[model samples]
Target: MKSHIAALLLATSAVFPALAQTLAVKTSAPERYVVKKGDTLWDISSLYLNSPWKWPALWQWNPQINNPHLIYPGDVLSLHYDSEGNPRLSLAKGVRRLSPQVRVVSDKNQAIPTLPLAVMEPFMRFEQAMGESDFDQLPMVLGSNFNYKMNIEGHLLYVKGDLPRGGNYGIYRKGDAYRDPDNGAILAYESILVGTGRVVRTGNIEAGKPSTVKIESVRREVKPSDVLMPISSGQSYSANFKMTQPVQAISGNIIASSNKLREFSTMAVVVIDLGRKDDLHEGNVLAIHRQSPTVIEKESGPSYIEDASSLDKVITQVSEWFGEENDEDSVVWHMPKEQVGELMLFKVYDNISYAMVTKTRQPVRVGDSVSSR
Candidate 1:
């Protein structure tokens, strides 16, 4: 019996050594620091961590700290020791009591108070169908030949042409003058007018024989040897103008917007009417209006729908502003889709874009009127 017991004890001890080694290797070390006002997780990671990408690891280690991105002045960070004496990060409130060996450094690099990224949400501008009057008039090719044909409506004139090596072409209608086909210059459409047309398609043409071309439609008459080239589609007509900088309404309107109210997609782009001309610039923050509920009462009998109580919501939340001038009419705003919301602007642009809500908790459609606070 004694010999048997000794053998069992030896086997148990052998298993214990393997488990111990595994536990020791799995333990992690703790890092502690004192939080100063204006210190953000982004700044702290930049200071200590070898790479800023490790910020998520630091955040996970310190789960107690709410709003990891937001830190107040004078918060204490402690590293907790595991059973094996491994250090792990921990957060504690109040003044930090330091030991002699630990040195506290003054973090001068603080985070600046700015609007959240949610405000500059991207928006999609669905292109309207091209009209007949918007079709190109001239058909010119650099190296390759082109086949041209008119649509049944007589509004559109299509051209099929192979582009020269690295050459491009744009389509334009003749207004009041004729153009010199060889020199690639415009004389006049109808002898005294300039022409305009909308670009229906864009693509690269390989150097080769011309392909079949068909004009979808046109608004005016088209002639042969018209000029075709590339130009900007046009300016966006947006009523939505998000304020980038704060404005003290001495005598104008004050607008606010929410990031949740904007609809943003990968290719979507939002344009605001505010810009340098409107005294708005980068690093500006603004408050957005929360959507409100609208209730309609029944006058005589039962309503058509079941739930007569109309659902209403308010737009609340502040968002940061980022974007540049889009054109003479508006400024382009770009942000991720998740952050779009309702916005309110204190002012409006004269004959230009206005701050409007493109999305809402409820059915907020285009052309809805928005006011500033």
Candidate 2:
């Protein structure tokens, strides 16, 4: 067993140069640090470098350690330099596994999440994008028991549609219409999650029989005309947060955000225009860029003297007073791109994606440009 561990460490160290080269370490980085629970790779990497995205380049994995990429509580990491003077990070001490084994593990306890999943989970769970034709034929709540205006827990709901038998459904309400950023055309509609309920009994939609659903839970007040959708079980929105490098180059704009705020910070979920069609996938890292304000140079000139001696001059002055001024020749300079924050795509659709802010050097705002290149 001792020999096996030694061999594993020797092999990992042998290939360190190619992987560790080009990785820049912060001037004030610590030589050694102890890993703690709830610590993400980004968080730990930020402690050692100015750019946390370069973590994979510097991370040196040990085959002897089980889940070496996942640094658990009480583990220690040390910084070292290879023969070529490249900075390399190594797991000095951590949990050990002699051999590889496959087993089921709960992400809640076993995995180190890329970010605070709780804050972003609610925004992702039922936020789905669908076309107008798809939503037009969806199941909708007709009326609750005794035609109640608002439905709550333990209330019976009558819905109009052919609901699946013996399965649960997520109750949703139609939200703000999502228009394309590039154009004004409607790309998809947003479904706002209200609650979860099971179809207690199904009825024939062809014969005008409304399905009966008993409310199992409630978040907002479920009401008539609310849409019912099948619960998402293993979809992209339900996947665990896994931090990874950007797989493809992407560029888009922030269209919306959680809480409908104009600006947000780390741990907040923001909606981007890029999606699966753009080759984005869950765990793909994207950088948020804030463009500096456009600069327009104005030449200094003396104010023109207005003379009322002529009727034509008086008419020109009147037009100038009420008319709008256009800066036709002012020099407009393009602002340099500044990376402000990094987000990990957790849920992606055809034309949209939901990403949580993992790191931010500046405040994230709506209309900010995002890219993976």
Candidate 3:
């Protein structure tokens, strides 16, 4: 956990010099504010800057302090001008200690995240992709204590499969199959996040049954045969918001949206095909484009052509002479591609990544083109 925290701290180090020159400070921005629990960097930046995405530009890293990116409850932050008249946020002086113990325990050492942690916490905790065989092999609820087919919160459930003693698992039902929007290839099956259950007993598998789980939390109806997978424990929030251009132009389709929404708009979560393999990562912003409809030119008889044989003979002679045909072919003209939105990738997987819709001129939909900004 310490190393993970350190890695996140290191990620917040760099700032774009060009963005600093164009920093847009809010007219009504507060001069100073106190950090608090659950205060995201985006939230704080929005309070001061018109464009919250330009946060790194105005953040002043204090080399004198250790882990400058780690801001916590009680640390005071104030906006001030540097020697060159550029605006910068500075951390106010506070209690200091030499020992590592004090530094670790101090409020200032707690790292702040770039986005709201709550937005991604449920996904990180309950959502996972599994193969069909793996999903079938997972422990499942056999029946309810009351013999109810559908179970709700506080219900007792009997599960059958290999059991790990005293572990909590998320109740997942089979959801939609995610497919590549560009080529219609199946990507993976999305597990429905139902609820949570805690193992109460490890029944003997030799007798053809094992494990009993109690439904502790239910977002939807829990039922018999619901698969149980262990919940993950990790921080899903990020602290980096650097905007970078792709090394090469990239284009992909929005395969799916969060919660299986059919249509998307600003602030919606959309999944795209680009990933680490495509040089995409968290903190990269992508532009969404909508292509224009195809147009086909109407064909009419050539103005001076009277005989079909004469035209065919002329075309044959031209082909033989130039090794190419001089035939009147249909032509198509297309409208310019229009930029519809921008998305910031927050979570990345192997072949897919999840991004939040940051800005949009129109409602983003499935199959919309996503290109690098």
TM-score of each: 0.24, 0.76, 0.70
What count of clashes does model 1 give?
A: 56
lDDT of 3 by residue, 1-373 (tens): 5465445434534334355567768888888777767777767877987556556567666654565455666667879988988788868777333445433333654566666666665555566655577678988778888877799988878888766767888899987777776577766677887888888877787898768788889999997778888864553444545544454678888888885677778768777877888877787777899886544333653322223355554655566588763545633344578998888787777677878887778888888889864
Question: What shift in Å separates residue 314 of candidate 2 from its native position after superposition?
Answer: 22
- Residue 159 shift from truth in candidate 2, angstroms: 1.7
Positional deviation of residue 367's Cα in model 3 after best superposition, in angstroms:
2.1
- Candidate 2: tens digits of C-alpha lDDT, residues 173-245: 8777666778866756778888989998887889999999999999988988888888755655333443455
Model 1 vs. true fold: TM: 0.24
Candidate 3 TM-score versus the reference: 0.70
Instruction: Please give the ranking of all candidate structures by lDDT, highest first, separated by commas.
Output: 2, 3, 1
> How close to the true structure is residue 32 of candidate 1, measured as C-alpha lDDT?
57
Model 1: per-residue Cα lDDT at residue 188: 22
Candidate maximizing TM-score: 2
Alpha carbon lDDT of residue 25, candidate 3? 83
RMSD, every candidate, angstroms: 24.4, 8.4, 9.2
